[model samples]
Target chain A: MAFLSGLSAFPITPSDRGGHVDTAALKRLVTRLCTAGVDSIGLLGSTGTYMYLSREERRRALSVAIDETGASIPVVVGVGALRTDEAVRLAQDAKASGAAAGLLAAVSYAPLTEDEVFEHFSTVARESGLPIVIYDNPGTTHFRFTANLVERLAHVPGIVAIKNPTEKPEEISSHLAQQRSMTPKGFPIGYSGDWSAAEAMICGADTWYSVLAGILPDVCLRMVRAAQNGDVEEARRLDATLSPIWDLFKQFSSLRTVYTIADLLGVSKAEPPRPILPLPALAKEKVAHCLTLLEQDLA
Target chain B: MAFLSGLSAFPITPSDRGGHVDTAALKRLVTRLCTAGVDSIGLLGSTGTYMYLSREERRRALSVAIDETGASIPVVVGVGALRTDEAVRLAQDAKASGAAAGLLAAVSYAPLTEDEVFEHFSTVARESGLPIVIYDNPGTTHFRFTANLVERLAHVPGIVAIKNPTEKPEEISSHLAQQRSMTPKGFPIGYSGDWSAAEAMICGADTWYSVLAGILPDVCLRMVRAAQNGDVEEARRLDATLSPIWDLFKQFSSLRTVYTIADLLGVSKAEPPRPILPLPALAKEKVAHCLTLLEQDLA
Candidate 1:
């Protein structure tokens, strides 16, 4: 895996009733993703409940993911922070802990000034031993990174790839087109939206970061392959069938919905973390319908 | 004094660059509050960066507030939780640790189901000795707490007051109308809206929580007294004088604005914790201007 450019199944972590990280269930998830032969193990991404975990838990989870994969797959630990010092510390920690790479979010709690984001990433990149990927998970108001900010970050010390989940496809594509030098120079932009992966790829996104891949890695990986092989027909077919499940991720909380999907697939363990309330009975049934559809598709 | 009629100032905590709680600064804050004689010492509320603090930091803060005040005033601690169990634990911890009462928010991070909210508060109230108030700091979410929900919650165990900070003035008044019957005979239905404390009090709010009070308690307490004395005209006059100071609190990050206000008033020795990022120079100047307004009012 040359710096992880395929289907990255960011495994959803199962939590205990006590809200501690369920390492036992996490082990089960790694085994499943390993069995499914996911391109790279991305732990502590947004879907992985990265922000919710305490520092010790985050460190332990990243270690677990890396140790479980056993160098067979690259492990990219998510290392986003609101403070520059904190992000840099995490980056340093991630590199020292043997992570293959670190994926950092654009901004956190307080909105970053143009120079702050650049300085923040530049420090992290300079300090970390491994390659760094920028994460644009601006679902919350805390971090709203504009295209200009990305450009400022593009030249930061060691940024290698980016996972952009912005709503605008044309804008992303246009931005990439303007910075045509970035991709071949090895800065691949990945698309994170499950609903728009195919379209994003069509719009110059070279990689795919799948939250849906947490439950159905094979299906999503196949869809990505089909799209790349210029099999738009095959890709669209899979997307249409998977749209229901994909919609559910955003309908409820992503952490909760993904955990439910994992439970339905019987791949991960029961229960999600605190702050993320569980699926109501009706939501569980709705999720089950999507699972059944995927089951039928597999059958 | 009977049920704290209007404008409870949620003093912003001072933290060092490393994010440790500024205890010396905290003592100064308490002394000022005691001297000012606000209805209550509303510690650890949202304006206090409750969400950003650790458990130890939270407990230490509550201890500091109570110790400085002695028996002179009541100290209300914000013991909200992201998890029901954590909320219960914090409530018990707060009660044992000497918070006069707990002014808990619905929860952190996740939106609450009406049932979950009831269960959360009831469990905390049942387990803890402290009188618990239900705080609806729903600026935390896209979700708003409805009057019907509050009405339903009135029957839940241990709910004393309703702390609402909504743009909608009617929400708390509506809850008060229901709470008049549901609350156990005595207590208040308080509303907090930064600078609009006089207005919220005029509309039947028994408590107004102020951030500016953490810095210049005398100015805020006098305004509260003016409002309580059936002097809306005088209160409005105070409101006109304090408007500039209030404007500063509104314009910047709550944590930063409050901390700067604390610094200007010569209260806390601490700054915002490491990860909160830094306030801009312009924001610092605005806070200084806010302090100048306070000085003018006091003079």
Candidate 2:
């Protein structure tokens, strides 16, 4: 459970054009996360294209990541699906495959009711016995999780934590405080959106659920460690230094930007599943430029 | 192509909890649409829980619907998937199975760019050789289609028409006019959202992509016929008469409400795929009452 409290790195699941998991390439990514010592490997997250993969492919990805991590780093698998039964089956697979927790998003196509989402989370948790992290990602799923709903789910038996979307830097403190006050004491609250995640962690958020960390874990880990040690100035300095990469992330979503970075670093050369194209050439140039800047500054 | 012009009924694809299509139940629903003389059958639409079913199940539904309708009606199958290649395959299946056209939504998990969607649609249309209807469903997909994007896609070789989400009733005329002015001449523009569809049809939108019509084709056909014949008063009257059902649709979603209606009317007893629960007891009672009122009034 404590593994859920630090820098959880979400990696892109390396796959071919046909959506089959490149298990060898995926293990390479997981090896990188373990080498950098990310607190947990967020396998099959949105960044991992969990929604695009078949259940068998997802199982393959999780199995590989779990095997690669080898009890050194916990793997938090994304078990979200449009159907509840499918999610339950996914969570079951993650549990059986040795994932530490299942990150469940309210992945919807019907624009689900809060009650339906609650029942969904509750059902998956109860049925699968996998510790669940409530993944509140509205940017993709379009289902926003309100504080009330988050608090309610936080109290559910197997629902242990939340991975909230980032707030504006100035709002991070209050957002964290409000969420902290609403949920059970000591229940971990994490933040995604790499740009603002430093501020969120500096504001005493429990974890940084980061897209950048998925590929560039060492620098992200430095930021998380700085914030963890209460070195607010050091964390802000790293945040400021990474501004160019953050700008790239903002421009060409973190998912696409990191895919380019992973390829540039020779970690994995897989394009995202289609409907999600790789960054265009000019964007790739910008991402490369940002990477060069990050290497110079972070070094 | 002309069949895309009038009352295009979107029936729910009846399926068990496991996402297998109930071909018998589906055939019954399609038979009703055809017997009631709907202009076209929109198989595997959002109301059909197309997003929830597997591609094989989708093919089974489309195949059954096409066979049930025979040559009497054109079946526009929903060919949407999170992956572009999968969508292309679905479109190909629809084409090979004798569907008249493929209804392609910009279904996304990564929150696609307009350019990505343009490519996704273009690729499916080009690769499958199936005529495509741009399914602009922002409510479910959360990917909006601007008029500019629609104009561009409308010009894509195999892309034939669009099924836009409902606009405000008062804005239906201007919305229709704006869309018509932007797209190629005679490119069919349709509206879903059963409540506003009558007004949209009266405003000269080419089709009513109706959820209600999927189950209750006769009454909806009367509304469409009235609008087509330039009897705005009669269409509006029909719209007003169905206000209660629309209200239920607004409250419980047309998909959920229609499922209850289908069961009550002995059309199909299948519930929506999980994560989209059926109407609860109170809501079911309301739906049953509205059906009684509608039966008395429409009869």
Candidate 3:
């Protein structure tokens, strides 16, 4: 929970053409993010393609990231699974691998109840024996965690923070206000849905759980810093630079577009996990243009 | 594929308190459905809580249902998994256990592409050696199979039929129209969203892959028979009788409400898989009232 603020870069799991983890590329990506001074490295995030990899592959990916980053930054490993037992096992593995915390998302193939969702995190929290970050990504999981549910999870032991999606700005603002009013100060709420990160930060989000940071840590850091410093105009300006990539993400998923960006940047050579392909021709051309503009701006 | 038409009853998996599949209850359910002359029995379906159970349990459940039904009717096993390899393995196991066909759903924990989905099913089709029925339940899978994707899958060898969700009647009608225009007559399309079965059937759907049929096969068969005999008025009347339970399904998932209905009927003692709890107290009261009205009408 110590590095629970600022920018947490979620890196893609670089993989070979055979879909095996490309450890060398993964190490390079992690090292680059750490060198760029990202506050933390989130392994196995949606961008990490955690769901596509096997359990052993995912555990290995976590260890490789943690070992490469060393003590320079915290490592938050995504331990989400469709089943509670599988999630608990992954969380335990993250703890054994020296991850700073386990990010848990309740991914369900069946419709889940409020009590069931609460029980899922509570069980993972107790069994993993590591600080847990509740990942409320409804887009991928198709299960929304309402503010009321978040408040209930806040009281569960070991659940120390949250990575909330920022689809609805007004809803995010109202929920953050209600959560802030709750006792014990509530868990620190961070924002994903990178396109809306600036608005969420401006609305008092504690951290930016970002996909953009994974590929372009420096610019993402600058945006987060501007928001943290209350430099609203500067934050908006920095955020505008992410617009081209955001446009592609809106059309497709960030899960697909980010892999293309990483591949284009030569920071990593990852094929987005199978079943999810690399960007199509037009999308790739658009991404290349976006990267060119980003490079010139950074220069 | 002989049993591809009429009512294919998807039984709620009867599970013990510890969540293990209750084989005796499963057998009872299968015997009841088979005796009632339902066209086929679908095991390990969304209603069967396939994702909630582990691989071994799923295989065991399939075997029990197959054994109980004993070729009196075909058994279509839901062989959905997050990984293609896992799905193939399940499909093979279903074949080895004497299941008539494998229901292949592209259930991804990650976002997938059209080509990726095509490959997932095509690979399973070639490898499993079982007749494959593509299960297109986008509500659970989070990945929609466009008519384009379905056309692609229809060309895959061993892919014989489709169990399509009927959430949007217009969309289903449009897609079916587009699909019917393609050569080889394509695969037979079945409807799953029970509340809309009559509409789908009237729209030229080949079968009703029904959850309600698993518990109340006589009533379900009556509806399907009416549809089959071109008794649209009778079909509408029968479908209207399902409205009360359908109301519960719209509120929660059919997976949960059907379990409550089955429990109330004493046909089987079952709970929906973990993370998806059985209906709460108020919902249970509502289901009981609906069942009483239904029972009185049947009498």
Candidate 4:
């Protein structure tokens, strides 16, 4: 697949026009990503609005992505929920869908203590042989994982990488350094915060969940490769071009903006699943500007 | 079963030794509440840890509380979920459990916008037929429900009350006044944010959700009665004993102290459902002290 080493946009999969799994469009999207040289597909993930999809939709989406991508790239499915049992069930579902690994968010109802977090991850990791990315964005957990917790979490088997919270670069660097040191050699340590991809890579994050990669895959892949090659000048230049999309993410809730921008780009034009805020008028314009830049320049 | 109007504990439906629903113990607890003359039973609710329990467990807990209490008081069952369908299902389940009404926390995903919040409450309210209470406390939601949003939501038919967030008295009051002006005349608005009951009551929040009520129902009811009777001085003195309990809720990420205090007081010793944090050492001591003081000085 030549997909394991570079960049891919964590594309937000659109809901079906008829309000279910858009399997046909999903195949089209998969074919598009494959055509664009996206290294991986994080299907039915946070970017794909995993929480909004029903259990059946999640399974269907993953199956379709796997079928269309056809063993070409690894698919990191996001298994997040308020129930560990449900999360584990989804992990098994992901496996059956031909997932390469699971990006499991530690779903706690009443914020779990550090020990419970360890247990939550450990339990899920044990259920599947697939390498599990312990998604440690405490912003969702509402219980931040401290450096000590990271040290402790690193020891759990099948815990291959950490997709950490990095809205702030300083905190991102702190996390990247801690996880990098604690992780075994060649273990994937990724950043979910794409805003600071260059710095995250510079600080130590080897892999990233790039939101921009969905619309601007070539640009995102070029930047990641440039950073990986230690070509700082080239990485920064590409990042500058992708800056408008990055700025738009800051204008709304990061997760919601991922879908809003996708909708604007024609890559994913379906309505956001219910209970998610639609982009505001001002921000919708910003999304248009960003999409225009991508279509005319980056794409 | 002459439950009066005032603050009362959210009863934790005692699980049998092997984690089965304990109807016998539940009746005993009801006997105690009846003897103590509590205002109402908050059952199959958060203190009830409703989400962690299976739908069957939720039904059993609510049915037992209702069967024993037998229309002598109101039971507000907490119904919340990540999806509208589940919330509606639980709301119907709450009605089946013989609850007076269902109190719904906003869906679990972070940053619920105004539209999502409106849909969440409206969906639950329309389906339940029972009176509705919108539980809006960011301590859990991590996303505040603005006054404007609440004002709009207050218009949903069959919605009877607002469980308003009261972490700050002045802020809660400002919102309360705004909501009251916009809402229907009879819509009851309650306050959440422990240890602020007196201030909440004075500042247009006529109803109070007392954490201490879960353990020290007698004292909590008395305090609410005192406040309702225009005896602010007496209410303050009663509220004084609850300071330690509020301190404990603030101390931990897991909120283990909430359930532990209930256990220590001999109200009902149901183990916290999984994914909950354990009470920290100092918080446990503080909770114990609060329970002891309630028994000695108020209960």
Q: Stretches of candidate 2 above 4 Å error?
A: none
Candidate 3 regions with alpha-carbon error over 4 angstroms: A1-3, A16-20, A167-178, A182-186, A202-204, A230-234, A265-267, B1-3, B16-19, B167-179, B182-186, B202-204, B231-237, B265-267
Across A125-242, the per-residue lDDT of candidate 2 in tens digits comes to 9999999999999998989898889989999999999999978989989998999899988899999989999889888889999999899899899999999999999999999999
Kindly report the docking quality category of candidate 1: acceptable
Q: Per-residue alpha-carbon lDDT of model 4 for A1-299, expressed as tens digits?
A: 12234564576666753348776666766776788877787776666778777678888888888887777778888877665666677888887778988887766556566787787777778876666777776665577878787777777787777676774666777766666687666666777767788777656566767776765577778888788889988888777777777787765766777667656656566656655657878878877877777667654
lDDT of 3 by residue, A202-289 (tens): 8778889999888889999998889888999989898887788788888878878888888887877677655566777898898889
> Largest DockQ belongs to which candidate?
2
Q: Is model 3 an incorrect, acceptable, medium or high docking prediction?
A: medium
Which lDDT values do the candidates have, in the order given? Answer: 0.71, 0.91, 0.83, 0.70
Tell me how many clashing residue pairs each candidate has.
11, 0, 0, 3
Tens-digit lDDT track of model 2 for B160-231: 999999899999988888888888888998999889988898888899999999999999999999999999
Error of 1 at B116 (Å): 4.8
State in Å the error of residue A140, model 2. Answer: 0.8
Candidate 4 has an lDDT of 0.70
**Chain A TM-score of prediction number 4:** 0.90
Question: Which ten-residue region of model 4 chain B has the weakest summed lDDT?
Answer: B1-10
How many residue-pair clashes does candidate 2 contain?
0
User: Candidate 4 lDDT, tens digit per residue, B139-191?
Assistant: 66576777777778878787777776665765766767777798887677777
Clashing pairs in 3: none
